[model samples]
Target: MASDMPNWFAILQAQSYSAGGTVPLQCETSATYIAKVIRKVQNQGYAFISPSHEATADFNDVVSRFFDDKVLSESCNSWVKMGPGRSRNLVWWPGTAHRMEISRDPRWEDFVFGRAKETRVNRVAYFGNGWTERERVGGVESITNYLKEAGKGDLATLHEAWNE
Candidate 1:
């Protein structure tokens, strides 16, 4: 079980792909798998836990480019919430949303024989990140109730139909 994150990730990816836009979630959120792992590799220069499947290659490829890119490796520490000394132009605090992109192409000439481009920090903004646990568990029921109370039954009906 300790070494199963990647495998779980592979299964989750497959499930998500099969199930369409909605993530295949149970108790924990999908962020625990995708976002956390990507953030970890971006900061540490390697995957915290590599997936045993071929999917590992995709995740590794992106992080490896980060290690090779000077800008990212040098500024990786500031993205986390440990302190205020992080890079001035970029930041991704803990328990909140964040994103980054590596522009290096491993299959191209510059990746191996030519000069590599600098990495750019991307910080994405997400809403409702600090909701309480009780609020989360009752999300669907509460939202449905709220919609009904607010005379938005049509929207709730549309949502239920879309989910089906």
Candidate 2:
């Protein structure tokens, strides 16, 4: 729903963050938000990487409105390929105590973006929706339960995205 593109706020809001922000307020609002949340996921023993569908669509629209594909293809870096067939529902890196790891490094961003990293395939874990996987694990429900046990189940953080 935002017309802004590529800016940090645009990126966040585009990714379905429903915080208190309008066009002018988005920058400051988003900055404050990022400050609070950065590296917070590491405390939970994992990092979250979800699609910014709105942002992506807005970016393409901007490109068409202001420029052309040649400029875009040349200036923009290659996008990470993410999907069910190529990758899994989740990409996980191990953390201390044999849990998931969340890093703030560029490589971590690449992984979050779902960029190809064949070498890490053996080192990292990918969970899909296979029957065997379901039998072995309880999917998101299990993870939510684990978070509650770990004292990381504060619903406020999740709900804070929506601007009341």
Candidate 3:
């Protein structure tokens, strides 16, 4: 006998917003979904543990683009000391809330491409910011709560919320 694996829908719903307008998620691509799922998995204390070169490259490229586009300007000054062989896994530390790392795995490409449809579906399921303020007020509390909950797990949550 084997224990049942967790359902992605259950996991996602558990992390869904408690209070917000009912806006539907809409992911634009499979790659985006894959990234979000990866973030969620990472947030759960599970390493992405990729098994293919292509997956590793995909992860790296997406991460690089995310940091370069969104984080570089505001948080570039902080430096995180790296071990001799840890350069590849290091990125700028954003105070105590955000940390980024990258590692290589030869098997991720296989997993990603092999389950392309699943990836696309997840990407679609986990898209968009589900909340907005009436007068343009930022939902900082909501956002922080979401991040704190998601960050407690793995990178999968981060990826899922990347576009949000």
Candidate 4:
């Protein structure tokens, strides 16, 4: 079966839209599909996997612009806009947390575009943080539980208190 990540992402995005907020996910965390594929193409000799040259270039450009946008306050470790009526700076990094945006941090390039030395690829691609299996799995379960309960509780109370 195909991975459920995409469906999970769609559900989260839909919730954000309904609540008048941006998706409550870090860009790198949620967009790991490309990163995983890139890693596979490099490590597994998946020559059939190819992103058009133009598409790759455009993605790099977009990353550059995201870092350049001061208003958005993006960085290698930054929270995106969360649910409506919630602090835009709030995020879940193992738990409720906040990060300071480091303007044009060089690590952002490495985090987003660098490959490990062992990889076959001689080019930059998506590289997110190193997450242990327990952290990744537990985090997802935690969020799912929170969403299920909060969705029920918030609707009952007619207020959004999920982030509280």
Say which candidate scores most in TM-score.
1
Q: By the TM-score metric, which is better: model 1 or model 4? A: 1
Q: Give the TM-score of each candidate.
A: 0.24, 0.21, 0.22, 0.20
Local distance difference test values of all predictions, in order: 0.34, 0.34, 0.35, 0.36
Ranking by TM-score: 1, 3, 2, 4
Per-residue lDDT tens digits of candidate 1, residues 93-139?
Answer: 11112221221111222111111122122221112255644458867
lDDT score at residue 75, model 1, on the 0-100 scale: 42
Q: In model 3, which runs have C-alpha deviations exceeding 4 angstroms?
A: 1-50, 73-75, 80-164
For model 2, name the residue pairs that clash. Answer: 95-99
Residue-wise lDDT of candidate 2 within 34-152, one digit each (tens)?
A: 44344433322333333256654554554344323333223333332123222211111111211111111222222233222432453233323334443356665643432445555
Tens-digit lDDT track of model 3 for 44-162: 33423333455445555654554454433344343331234223224432222221112122123344222233344454433334544422375555445445564374676666454
Stronger candidate by lDDT (2 vs 4): 4
- For residue 51, model 1's alpha carbon misses the true position, in angstroms, by 3.8
Local error of candidate 1 at 88, Å?
23
The Cα RMSD of model 1 versus the native structure comes to 19.1
Per-residue lDDT of model 4, residues 1-164, tens digit only: 01222212222221122112245534433344445454454544333343344544564454445334444344334445443322233222211212112211222222222244544454432233455454577776644443554445557533334433
All candidates: CA RMSD in angstroms?
A: 19.1, 17.7, 18.3, 17.6
